[model samples]
Target: MKVAIASDGGNVAQHFGKCQEYAVFDVVDGRSENFSYIPNPGHQPGFLPKYLKGLNVDCIIAGGMGQKALNLFAENNIQPIVGISGEVKQVMEDYINGKLTSGASLCTHPDGQHHDCDGHC
Candidate 1:
């Protein structure tokens, strides 16, 4: 499976659409490999889902995502793992070990703004 983690520097970005880049990984037999980074093309409504879909991404990991983007990912058959925050490598390890669990969506806006979470990401 191909996984894409919304990233900023070496850590997971707080918001999917506003992330600076994506850390893409190829996983096989519960192991992750072929890790690479892809620059965020830009944040446009409905654009990212299609873009990642075009890249053949099977899943997305992020700290938060708007409802519309989540729906778009669903329509594209991409599993979205939200409410994750940590170093990219550690997060990937957690996912590989099946220890990662999605929490309540940190973003409340359909437009991908960081308006919720009580200023605590």
Candidate 2:
């Protein structure tokens, strides 16, 4: 399976729309096999979903995302997992180990307010 994690400077970006890049990880048999970074094309309405689809992304992992963006991913046959945080590598590792789980989206407002309480992003 191939998953893309919204990233910024090697860590999970808190807001999907503002992520600097995507840390794409390819997993086989629960083992990560490859990793790469694709700089974000841009975050215009109705753009990222299609862009990620073109890359054949199966899923997207992020700390937070707006509902519309999440729905767009679903429409494109790409799963969106929100409320993930921390270094990109460790986040991917936890996912492979089945230790990561989606929680309430961190950026509920999506109006650019109070999303990064921890200031990691």
Candidate 3:
């Protein structure tokens, strides 16, 4: 599976929309295949989903994200795991070892728009 971890420096980004980059890791049979850090292609509404989808990402791990972003991932069948923090490599290891479990969002949307919360888009 291909997992994308929202990153800021070396830790998990505080917010998905505001993340500086995404560390794309490819795992096959529980073994890492390749990894790369790609700068975010901008988070314009409805655009990032398409961009990420095109990259063939199967999952997205982040600290928090807007409901719309969650919906976007849902539409693409990409699992969205939020409320994650810590080193990117460790997070991936936890995930691979089945020790990683998601929790509620840790950050809030700054725009205060309709796409704010509600857990739905």
Candidate 2, superposed: residue stretches over 4 Å from native: 110-121
What's the TM for model 1? 0.88
| Better model by TM-score: candidate 1 vs candidate 3 | 1
- The residue-by-residue lDDT of candidate 3 on 10-57, one tens digit each, is 899977767899999988898777899999887677776678889999
What stretches of model 1 exceed 4 Å from their correct place?
108-121
Find the candidate with the highest lDDT and give its number: 1
Ranking by lDDT: 1, 2, 3
Error of 3 at 1 (Å): 1.0
Query: TM-scores across all candidates?
Result: 0.88, 0.87, 0.87
lDDT of 1 at 78: 98
The superposed Cα distance between candidate 1 and the true structure at residue 108, in angstroms, equals: 4.1
Best-to-worst order by TM-score is: 1, 2, 3
Q: Candidate 1's residue-wise lDDT over 33-104, tens digit each?
A: 899999999887788899999999999999888677888999999999999999999999999999999997
Query: Residue by residue across 1-117, what tens digits does model 2's lDDT show?
Result: 889999999999888878899999798987988799999887677788889889888989998877777788889999988888899999999999999889878775556554443
RMSD of 3: 3.4
Which consecutive 10 residues in model 1 have the weakest lDDT in total? 112-121
Q: CA RMSD for every model?
A: 4.2, 4.3, 3.4
